[model samples]
Target: MFCASLADVFDNSVDLAWRADLWALVRDTPHLDWLVLTKRIGNVSAMLPADWGCGYGNVWLGISVVSQDEADRDIPKLLCLPAAVRWLSLEPLLGSVSLQSATGPFGETLDWAVVGGESGPHARPMKAEWVHDLRAQCGTLAIAFFFKQWGGHENGK
Candidate 1:
């Protein structure tokens, strides 16, 4: 399950005591693979719990890569951090991104990538070729790819 869905867990505004409580729960729930996505990838090292040796087996870290500039800047940071699974989320995909495709512990570039267009009244449209290109890149590097949506004002079953 995703924690801090509406707020950033890395936000300094959140009390340290509260985060400690959450970490305690995360430690107890070994059966759940906590998928944590953050825009604050830079804050991870300093904020990590003392028990986070190398990385936690149950936690998967994902970072946002909205555009080429961000991908270039953030992907490298993620590469240095150890995790069971390191993924990229190109959601609300703004433009074509040259991920350049790096690798994981076992040589997989990305454990997975989730691609999706923006969704809202003024949602921006995304191109099929963009998705195709990202999928191709992942395929070439042996990374898993998941297409979340074409996206629109309406989201229904």
Candidate 2:
């Protein structure tokens, strides 16, 4: 399940009690694997539940990155957290990104990468080379790569 798809679970504006309630819901639903994607990677370490030691088994924590700068700044933070699965959402990929430099405790501990171009009315064009390079990097690193869609007025390659 995609947890908080329209809103960020780690956003500072979110009420503490509400976040607790959400954590309770997540704890109760052990059968479902929750994919929690957030752009606020820096806020996660402090906002996580008190009992989130080594992270929950059913939770897959992911960080969203649109370019190399964001990736470089956030991937390391995401890798530091102990999650059952650590992944990246490269949606609206605005520029080329090289993940080869992102090393963590267990080397590059990223388990998966969901890549795609920008979408919507004002979406910018995503170069085919950028996507291909990312895919190749993921292949070399043994990270699962998923190509979601090509952005901007068109679909597919």
Candidate 3:
């Protein structure tokens, strides 16, 4: 959790041997729970180690989503994979999103979701109503909701 927050381990841009060494580190670090959050989630299945029988016990797989389009396109793929836990990050929320269609074709839903606005001089603004709506939806669906922040240009707004 304390390591690279923005670097996706499944990224194919990196060297295979480097990825292997990283996975090896994750495998050997039995005391730490590794959270691999990525936007390149489509490459996840191919990036997994051969020994990932049913996925590692300490690893959590999550996808980054900025809007409904990404969520709709990625969540289904995420559900098909095996993992200790699955989640979504709505950080730097760019637009409103509805999770109603994000469920399984049957009725499955995600395990966790995080919501936060953008921050920085160049950051775009977000609506508080959007975050509230997401919280309500998570409540109704029993998905864990972690409200990270109400971002602004300065301070933790």
lDDT of each: 0.80, 0.91, 0.82
Candidate 1 stretches with Cα past 4 Å from truth are 104-108, 153-157
Error of 3 at 21 (Å): 1.3
lDDT of 1 at 138: 86
The digit string of per-residue lDDT tens for model 1 on 32-143 reads 9888888898998777788888678888888978888888888888877877788888988878876684653455456888999888888887877788899998898777
Candidate 2's displacement at residue 119, Å, is 1.2
Superposed model 2: Cα runs more than 4 Å off? 106-108, 153-157
State residue 7's C-alpha deviation in candidate 2, in Å: 0.6
lDDT per residue for candidate 2 within 1-157, as digits (tens), equals 9999999999999999999999999999999999999999999999999999999999999999998999989999999888899999999888899996567967648999999988888788888888899999999998999999997736434
lDDT of 3: 0.82
Q: Write the per-residue lDDT of candidate 3 for residues 1-157, one digit (tens) a residue.
A: 6345958777778789988998899899978888788898889999999998767888878888999899888989887777777788998888888887657654556889988878788887777778888989899988899989778733333
Predicted structure 3, TM vs. truth: 0.89
Top-lDDT candidate index: 2
Q: Per-candidate RMSD vs. true structure?
A: 3.1, 1.5, 2.4
Clashes of 3: 0
